[model samples]
Target: MEQYKRKIALTNARFYAYHGYYHEEQMLGNEFFLDIICFVSNPTLNTDDNLVKTINYEELYRIAKEEMAQPKKLLETVVDNILNSIKVNFHEVNEIEVSLRKSNPPFGGDAATAEVSLYWQSGT
Candidate 1:
């Protein structure tokens, strides 16, 4: 079997929104970083052409931005939305992994950041 992999890593994808359980946190939105990895089946390798045969990363970025803009109580929910959005929008993508990180959370702690990642593949 032939496999074509194309990875689009967007680091430090900053999104400011209220997404915490605490009252103060929910009222005051914070910045979050999102990293997305999309494993797609490249058609250009077989056809030797770049005519709508590959995934449109620009569109993916738009989708991610839209999803990230929405405020959610849990990072898990946001990650899930990102993965599901990609899966539905891009059919060529066989698998996707989304990592959402909240940098310098309101909760004062030793940890620098808090993150949640979700992996979703085709079928079950």
Candidate 2:
């Protein structure tokens, strides 16, 4: 199963979201970077010229957009939504890894950003 699986990376996919532990953050909103790696159980993607043989990137983007539109207090929640959305939408997807970074977090510190990452499989 591992050998036949393929990884598709979506890097620095940007979105504007109202997700934070603070009230100001929810009001002002912020820029978010999402990186996703989808493990598809299709070796044919390596050789098949047709995109139909692999997961569609457009559909993935739509899923991300919809998930981000809903506000959440924690990045973990967002990651969960993304993973579950993908798993539910695409049956061929066996596993997923999602990283969400909030640029310029509200924390009054020298840190540039705060981020959370989650890895999920279809089943235990």
The 10 consecutive residues of candidate 2 with the worst lDDT sum are 40-49
State TM-scores per candidate.
0.83, 0.88
* Residue-level lDDT for 107 in candidate 1: 73
Please identify model 1 stretches exceeding 4 Å from their true place: 46-51
57 in model 1: Cα distance from truth in Å? 2.2
Q: Write the per-residue lDDT of candidate 1 for residues 39-64, one digit (tens) a residue.
A: 76554563666647666667777888
Clashing residue pairs in candidate 2 are none
Best by lDDT: 2
lDDT of 2 at 85: 88
Q: Which candidate leads the pack in TM-score?
A: 2
